[model samples]
Target: MDGDNPRTPLLSIVQESYLPKTVSIALKCILVGLNIASIAIGVIFMNECPGQYLIPYYLIISGVACLLFLCMTCLPCVDEEQVTSVTLANLCAQGVLLLFLFAFFIAGNVWIYSLYHGPWNDPSSPEYCARVLYLYAFWIITLCHLCFLVLLCTYLCLLLGLYILKRSIFGSRSS
Candidate 1:
């Protein structure tokens, strides 16, 4: 009786593969939608959010992480046959994209909204300076946003690398 459903940890592990194909494709679609929305919002709300809330930049990072996780878990590591080979380089690229999104688009912009009064002000006092600093940070923030943009490109590059890797290792073409 007990033998009928014997516990097999390894079997369960293999059964619970990392990513489902439907989920991966759906996530990729979501990412495309998000990027388009951000671009559109940035265009529409140019005054209020400028370039900040256009598309929820963190989504890009999240998208990348999701993709990488899908890749790692959906397909087993070609070389190691062990789980540890997934590189930090991939994770970090995704993380940097997320951090930039939160800091520049979410936190920094909100700070501006909170402190913002009008277009004109006496540029003096520490508080004003802080606001100015944040204002200055807008460029840095923009740079960070751009960094995420590039990070997005980098994520794609990694995928391309993965394709090459898969081909070389398994003689398999990415479907």
Candidate 2:
């Protein structure tokens, strides 16, 4: 392939193949719904525990970012060159952000679980229902974060593999 008119990057090819028109639309819709549900649950948990702002805040931000990503995916993939840079950059940025969010969600879940599952693990406690609800909400948020993290990792790995392949192929030719 000519250097100037290079083939579409492997990452873009994988994304396009995996997320075709029907699949992309469906995935986008599902992601939006999940994000909205997770945000609403996070808000409810936040109301119960005003002092714990970390999880809910991150949850809100992740939801917004996911929506933005969905919108980006919807754009027509007209020019391969135009889409490559923006899509790769967006993927990398989102992957990094998701890593941090994943860590926060894991920590938050553990902390919340410890707080509610200790000596105060009594059903008779007046706030027991609220505690359970909060825990459940945190669990849901953690699961959502986990899903996104998995997707991010998959894309990153594909991108890395493609990069290495391209390097070896071009390097051998140059030699």
* Candidate 1 Cα outliers beyond 4 Å, as residue runs: 1-17, 48-86, 108-175
State which candidate has the highest TM-score.
Answer: 2
Candidate 2 regions off by >4 Å? Answer: 1-4, 50-55, 75-88, 119-136, 139-175
Tell me the TM-score of each prediction against the true structure. Answer: 0.32, 0.53
For model 1, state the Cα shift of residue 17 in Å. 6.3
RMSD of 2: 7.4
lDDT of 1 by residue, 57-138 (tens): 3333333444454454434334545543333455455567566545546654554444455432334432342233335334
